[model samples]
Target: MNLFADMRAVVISALDQMVADGALPEGLDFANVAVEPPRDAAHGDMATNAAMVLAKPAKLKPRDIADALASKLMDDARVALADVAGPGFLNLRLETGVWAGVVQAALEQGSGFGRSDMGAGRKVNVEYVSANPTGPLHVGHTRGAVFGDALASLLDYAGYDVTREYYINDGGAQVDVLARSVYLRYLEAHGQEVAFEDGTYPGDYLVAVGEALKDKVGDAYVDTGEQVWLEEVRDFSTDAMMDLIRADLAALGVEMDVFYSEKSLYGTGQIEAAIADLKGKDLIYRGTLEPPKGKVPEDWEPREQMLFRSTAHGDDVDRPIQKSDGAWTYFAPDIAYHYDKISRGFDELIDVFGADHGGYVKRMKAAVSALSDGRVPVDIKLTQLVRLFKDCAPFKMSKRAGTFVTLRDVVDLVGSDVTRFVMLTRKQDAPLDFDFTKVLEQSKDNPVFYVQYAHARVCSVLRKAQAEGWDMSDAALAQVDVSGNTHEAELKLAAKLAEWPRLVEIAARTNEPHRIAFYLYELAGELHALWNRGNELPELRFMQDTAEASAPKIALARATAIVISAGLGILGVAPAEEMR
Candidate 1:
C-alpha cells in the first residue's frame, strides 16, 4: 500500500473531474504531473505540480488552474486539505488515518512490504568485479563487488530478473605474468632457489599453487624452458588464482551466476561473429586514430588498424578492434562478451567497473548499441577508489595482494555486513573513505550500527512486551486494533514507512542501489526518534498493562520493525536482533 501512489491516483482522478467540468483542456498529457513530498516539510505533507505543468498548455494562468484543482482535490476523504501554494503548486495534507493505514499495511506485509514490480520482470545481466585472475581481489575490486551484488539484490527486490556475472580476463598478458611467477614458485618447490624479477608476482599466496604443481606433475617440467611449460602452467595458474578470487568473493557474501572466460572467445569464432554483426551494419572499418590529446606516447604513429565506428553510437571516436600487428586488441573480446550477453536474450546489461575504466564506458556502450541495434540498453556504473583509514591515519597496504589492500583484510577488520554497508554509503562514482576505527564504533555516527541498532531496539521492545505477558507474535500483532493511536510522532514514522514502495521504484529506475541504503538510514532515524519519544510519554510506549490498551501502540512498533527488516534485506544486511 503506497500512500503516495494512492494519493497520486486521487489527484489524477480529481484532474480528470476538472477536465469533465471544462476547467482544463481535454486529452492533456499527465505524465509530467508528479505528486511528491514538498521541498519544505512545513509546506504540506505532499505537493503536486499538475496545475503548474498544465498552465501553458491549457492557456490558463498557474494560480488559476491550481485554485480549481485544489477545490476538487479537497473532496477526497483521505485529503485533509488542498491549498494552492506559490504560483501553481497544490499542497496536500493527508488525514492521520491514512498514515495509520500505512503502519497496518507494513505489519501485514512483513519483509515483502516494499517489494515492487517496477521492472515488470525484465531480464537484466549485471557484470562486475571482472578482475584479472592474477591474485586475490583487492580493495578496489571489493567496492565494485559489494556495489554490484547489492545492486543485483535491489533489482531483484524491484522485480527484475537479475543474473550476476563475472568476465574473467584470462586472455590478457597479466595471466602470462602470473604463469611465469607460478613457474618460479614451482622451481622453488623443487628445492631450487629463485628470485622474482620486477615484472613477476612476489606474493607468498602463490607459494601453495607452486607446491601443488609439484604434487600434481612431480617436476615433469623441471629445468625446462618457457616453451616446455608456459602454456600448461598458464592454464593451471589461472585456475588456481580464480579459485582464490572465488574464495575471497565468497567470504564477502558474493556469488556469481556465471563466470565468462575471455579465452573462450579466442578459439570459438565468437569474436568474429560479434565483429561480423557490427560490420554488417557498416560500423567496422580499417582506420587511423588521432593521437590522444595532451600527452601522446613517445612511439605514437598513425597506423592503419581495424576499428569500430563507435562515434556513430555516441563515443568520442572510433575504437580499434584489432592492432596493427593483426592481433585482436583488448576491446575485441569485450565486444564479443557483450554480444554474447545480447544473444542470451537479456533485456538489459549493466557493468560495474572501476573509475579508471571511465574512458572505456562509451566504447563498450557503443559496441552493445551496435550489436543489439539499440534494442538492449547497457548501463555502466564506475565505482571510484576506496581510501582506508585506521586511527585517523591511512591504513597500510596488504602483503597478500602485493600492491593494495585485499577484500578479506577489510572484511576481517570489521565484518562482511559493515564492509558492505560502508562501501555503499557513498555514490558509486564518488570516492569513499573506509575508516576501520569509525566503522567499528557503536555510535549513531556509524550508519551501519545505527540502522542495525534500530532493528535491535525494536526486537528488544517486542521481547520486553513478551516477558510482560503481552502477546506480540505476528499472528498476535495482526489482531491489534490501531484505531486509538494518533500521536504525531507515531504518524510521522508511519509516513516514512509509506515511502518504501516509492523509494524502491526510484532507486531501481536510477540503477543506484546506494539510494536504498540512504533511504534505510533515514527510515531508521525516524523510527529511532519515535522510539526515543516514548521515554518522555509513557502512553506512547509499546507495552501496556492491559492488552486492550497496548495493542494499537505495540502494533505500530511491530510495523516499524517489519519495514526495517525489508529495507535491510534489500541491502543484503542481516537485521540484528541484538547489538553486542
Candidate 2:
C-alpha cells in the first residue's frame, strides 16, 4: 500500500540485477541509497541519489553509474521514464496508475491508511505533564499535555507499545505549602478569616479542597500545630489536586496509562536500590564539585558530597546525589523514577518536559544511560511556552488559578478540539501564540477549521449522493475505476495521499508530532485545491450528470476524507462532519 516503499523496492531490485549482470561491482553498499520525491514536480515524480552516493564507494564515475541504473530501472512496469539527471541523480516518472492506486488504498484502509510498523512493537514510555500537584494545571502544562498525548498516539500508530504516563510531583516542599494553604481555607470554612502568607498557595481553587477537608474532619485539627496534621493534610491536598488535574486532562480528551507518584519512590527502598545499582557499577563516589564559573556568590562554598559520575555518560559535570546534610538531592528521586521505568522492561523512554526544564535533559539521559548500561535510549522533548491572546491583546482569564491561566480556562473558552489542534500547530521547541481571535475564525487562515472543513465537504458530498439513491458506501466507492482521474489537481491530491505513510514514519522516528499537523495542513490544502478547481471545470466536480460518470470523482474525495480522519485521530482532534 505504500507506493514510495514499493518503488524503493523496485529500485533496489533493479540495482541488484545490475550487479548480477556484471554491470556494477560486486560488494557495493546500497544502504545510503534513497528514493524520494524530487525537489520540483516539473523534474519528475521521484528522484534517487543511488548513483551519487555510490560513485566514490564504487570507484566509478557518477554519470556512468546513473546511466546504467537508469536503463535497468526502465525495465520495471512502474517506472514510465527513468532519466539520468545532471551528473548522478536519477529522476523517475511513475505511471499514472500508481497515483490512482494510492487513492484506492486510502478508501480500503480507512483510518488505518498511514499506520506504520517502524517501531516493530517495541515498548516505549512517554512521561509528560508532570506538573506539581499543588494547584490546577496551567497553560504551560496544557501545551505539554497536548504534545505528549499526540506523540503517544503517533507512536502507537507507528507500531510502538506506548504507555502514556504522568509523574505526579507531590513529594516536594510545594505540597507542604499546599497543605498549609488548605488549612487556612479549612479555618475559613469554620467561619474564621485567615490570611495566606507569601509561601502558601492563595488560589481560589484550593477553597473547595479546604471545605471538603472541613467536611471530612470537622474542627478537630483547627488549633493543631504543623506536626499534628501536616502529614495527614499534605496527603489530602495532593489527592485533591490530582483529582482536579485528571478532570482538566479529561476535558481536553487526554488520558494517561499511568499516574506515577513521586512519593512512592520514598520510604520504599527504591531510591537506595537505584543508587546501590549505580554504586555497584562504580558510578557513585564522594567528591567536591567545582565552584560557579563566573563571579562566585555568597553561598558558593564548595563541599564534599555524594556524587554520580554523570560526566562519564555524557553530562557536562558529575551530579550530586546527596546533600552535605545526608538527605537525598532532587536528582536522586528522578534517577530512581527512571530506574523503575527501566526495570519495567521498556525498550525506550521519552520524557516531555517544559522549556524551563531544559537544563535537566543531559543529566536525566545520563542517568538512564548509566542505569541501563547504555542498552536503553531516552529521548527528551521540551515544549516551549504558549502565549494566549484575545482581541489582539494579551489575555489572562484565570481568577480561580489566581496567577496563571488554567487548562480548563482555555478548553472552556474555545473547546477541546480547537485547544488540542491549536496547541500542536507549532514545533515543540518553538514558542506558540494561541490567539483566540484567529483560531476561532471560520476561514482558511485557521488551520483547525480548514482541515475540518475539507472533511465536512466530503461528508456533504456523501449525503447528497445518498439522498439521490446512489450507493456510496466505502465498499462501492473503492470498487470504482479512478484511473481516469487524470486532472492535474486530482492527481496532485493523490500524490499527497501517497506521502502519508512516509510522513508517519518520519514523524515517529524523529519524535515530532508537529510534523503530522503540518502534513495534514498540506494535504487539506491539496484537497481544497481540487475542490476549488471543480468550480471552474464542471468535469472535475464530484456530482456529475450520471452516477457512472461521478463515481470516480466521489471516490477520490472520500479517500481524501479518510486520510484526513486518520491524521486528526493522531492529533486527538475529532474530524468535523459539518461546519458550525
What stretches of model 1 exceed 4 Å from their correct place?
none
How many collisions per candidate?
0, 0
Task: Evaluate all candidate structures by whole-model CA lDDT and list the values in order.
Answer: 0.89, 0.93
For candidate 2, lDDT tens digit of each residue in 528-577?
89889999999999999888899999999999999899999999999999
| Candidate 2 lowest-lDDT run of ten | 391-400
| True lDDT of residue 100, candidate 1 | 70
Alpha-carbon error at 535 in model 2, in Å? 0.7
C-alpha TM-scores of all predictions: 0.98, 0.98
Steric clash pairs (candidate 1): none
Worst 10 residues of 1 by lDDT: 396-405
What's the distance in Å from true for residue 511, model 2? 0.7
Residue 372 of model 2 has an lDDT of 99
- Report the number of the highest-TM-score candidate: 2
